[model samples]
Target: MKLTLTIWRQKGPDSKGKFVSYPMDNVNPEMSMLECLDVLNESLAERGEEPVAFEHDCREGICGSCGFMISGVAHGPQPATTVCQLTMRHFKDGEELVLEPWRSRAFPFVKDLVVDRRAFDRIIESGGYISVSTGNAPDGNAIPVGKEESDRAMDAAACIGCGACVAACPNGSAALFTGAKIAHLGILPQGQPERDRRAVRMVAQMHEEGFGSCTNIGECTGVCPKEIPLEVIARMNRDYLGGAWRERKNVVTTIAPVSDWDFAKK
Candidate 1:
């Protein structure tokens, strides 16, 4: 098959970038999206041109190191599929595909299709952990967990931290990602000790990361390769509110600014 690609190309973080067009031919339908890019790079290398830079670790979908916007949709219009798992057959011959990196303030452009997702790393560092002592593994049934609770926690734990949720959102929100992190641990018995503080520190770090607030548009979950649900966002909000109430004498945070009239009256 033959296709045209208009891909965003940035040499570096401070470099000016633009869409560079390339006509691709003989593209095998079975070739994964990243494999297609690899073919393009091979052609560029033969011509003594700089190859387009993109990120991918395991060609499999587990690493979450590979993702990008394909033709205005995150992961190329496939539901619950990662780019590494997307194949050329999904698109028609002669189709013009536009490729770009994930766009978010927290995720600054690195190169061609790579964005700095390290902001996610910082969020995890803030509190996405439970204290564990060094010892032999505990007995399997030491702590009995209900099937429903275990299933929900496992569902939340499926988040791979791919930035598709941030890219698909109009608000560029990380609430879905952050919430998944919170819920996965919060629902488990081992994660109970740090639950309250984890919510506070993680939420605070999320704000500090410059990610936009979630308005519940549901786009994040729509493009998620793992099919992580929107329910995790609600769980995160509930935990955050509970933590805030306990820490601040029942005060809740708001997007609205302080009213000057009320201040003057006081």
Candidate 2:
């Protein structure tokens, strides 16, 4: 199949980006999007042209490293699929696929379709962990977890932090991503000890990162490659409200001027 790829090209974070169209005459229907890009890069290299820069690792879709807007839709038109898994067969012959990077203040543009997602790492660092003692691993059944809780935890754990949620959201909210991280652990017994503190710290960190507010428009989950439900956002709100209330006095001083509890209004 042949296709026209109108891709955003930016040399650096501060550089202006523009759409540059490249025509592909020998795209294989079975080739994944990244594989097709590899073919394009090979051609570019043979002609001494700079290859398109994009992020990818574990192209099977497990790493969440590969993502971008394809024709105004995050991760292309496929439902619950990553760009790495999207194949040329999904598009028609001579189709024009417009590719762009995730647009968000928290995710600064890098080069081409790549953007810095380190803000997600910072949010994880704020308190997305359990406080377990260093020693031999405990038996899995040692902590009795309810089946319902376990299932919900697993569902939330499916989030890959791909930034697709942020890109899809008109408000550029990170609520879905942040909520997933909080819920996966908050739903499990292993996370109870730091549940309240975890929600408070993570929410505060999310606000500090400059991500927009989530108005429950549901766009974030709509384009999620994992099909993560909006329930995680609700769970996050519940935990954040409870945590913020309990840690009101202490949190006020630490995250001053941020108004973390303001999220509850939304």
**Model 1 RMSD, rounded to 1 decimal:** 7.5
Candidate 2 residue lDDT tens string, 1-266: 99999999988765667999999999999999999889999999999999999999999988999999999999999989999999989999999999999998778777898887888988888888898888999886998999999999999999999999999999999999999999999999899988989998989889988899999989888899999999999999999999988874554212322222223223
Estimate the TM-score of every prediction: 0.92, 0.93
Candidate 1 lDDT over 51-111, as tens digits, reads: 9999999878989999999998998888988999999999999999999999987887778
Residue-level lDDT for 205 in candidate 1: 82
**lDDT values for all models:** 0.88, 0.89
Q: Candidate 2 — which residues are off by over 4 angstroms? A: 252-266
